[model samples]
Target: MPELPEVETFKQYFESTSLNKQIKNIKIKDTRILSIEENIFINTLRGKKFNSVTRHGKYLFVECNSFFLVMHFGMTGDLEYYRRGEEEPKYSKVLFEFTNNHILSYISTRMFGKLDITDDYKKYINKNRLGPDALTMSYEEFLMSLKRRTTNVKTALMNQRIICGIGNIYSDEILFRTQINPLTKINILQEYQLKELFTNIKEILKYGIRKKGNLATYSSKLIIPHRIEEENCPICHTPIKRYEILGRHGFFCPTCQKEN
Candidate 1:
């Protein structure tokens, strides 16, 4: 799945390449990915100018002349930018051809991503009941977001309604960085601990972006998950431990990150 850093990278890439361009055509390979009717989606986008591309959490927001387009990359979804007459890759699922001959493709190995059209983004957000974005959230605000939750630390971090943009992979990485146990209860986090968590969250996110958001897997470089199963710890040189938390694989260094 594409997390916040990856989504932000796509947002930046689209903004730089496809912004302010008029849509010449749109090709929807799979109708199931459309939240609205296919004809309506094509009608709403054709000939309209793309004002900007923004991302809130994992949702990509494409601002057109009349409405916003929300994109959720459920799993194995990615974006590709190409120019005219170039062979569209085999994985290019949806193609948005621009007047300037630039082609923006939404490619997914699995068809889980969705595209939705809405005039009022606030209404859509409220309908979805998403919480504040993790990248923009403040330390105090993050604590407040978790104050009411009685779930385990892992569950709280993975809850999009509690704090957006964090998924299973990043949550595990964040806990490792903060030395917080993944099984810790949300309500038990102290003030100083909350501060530490907040700090580590931002730090790890920034680091991931700088590393091109490939903390999971990417075709390029293929180096990710600094602490995978049986891998050596980057921090303490101890053997990294792998366990199950929230039904997902969690990796950490027992010597470096002590559970309290």
Candidate 2:
């Protein structure tokens, strides 16, 4: 799934490659992922332009005045741009053609992603109860949210209702960096440790966006690379261990992140 960093990268990519041009046509090659009636969707966006775009948590909003197009990139959603006469990308669910003949494709291998339009994004957000974005949330707010949760630290951080944007993968990275065991109860954390956790959450998520959401570009100490290589810890050379948290798998250095 595309997390906050990946979605942020996609937002920048969209602005640079597909912004400002008037949309000439809307094509939905796959009806499986449609959130609205095809005709309604086509009628709403075919002639209008995407005035601006923004991201909240893992969702992307393409705005045109009060109307907003919300994209939930489930599992494998992505964006691609190309000119006419070139081969269209494989697995492209929808295509947005501009008046200049350029195209933006919304591709998903699995049909999990959905594109829906709304007049008030605020209502939509509140209805779904998505918390403040991980990147923009204040440290005080984050601390307060976590302090209220009695769940394990990993579950607390990954809960979107508490603080959005972090999913399974980034939660592991944050806890590992903070040296907090995944199973650590939230109430057991000291004030200093909570502060450290908050700092690492912001720093790590920003670092991920800076690297364009490419795990290969991450620091050697990050567990992503270690998992990919099936190797020992980059910092301590301890064998990285994987344990199940809820339904997700978490990776940590046994020596570094002992149970609290």
Task: Output the number of the TM-score-best candidate.
Answer: 2
Candidate 1: the clashing residue pairs are none
Per-residue lDDT of 1-260 in model 1, one digit per residue for the tens? 58888788878878888888889999998888888999999999999888977677789878897699888888778888888888886766679998888899988778888888988777777788887788888876787788778887878888888888988778877887677777788898887888888887787677777766865443211113554677777666777778887677777678866766
Cα RMSD to the true fold for all candidates: 2.9, 1.5
- Reference-based TM-score of each model: 0.91, 0.95
lDDT of 2 by residue, 76-106 (tens): 9999999988999999999999999899999
Worst 10 residues of 1 by lDDT: 216-225
Sequence-dependent TM-score of model 2: 0.95
Q: Which parts of model 2 have CA positions greater than 4 angstroms off?
A: 228-230
Whole-model lDDT, model 1: 0.79
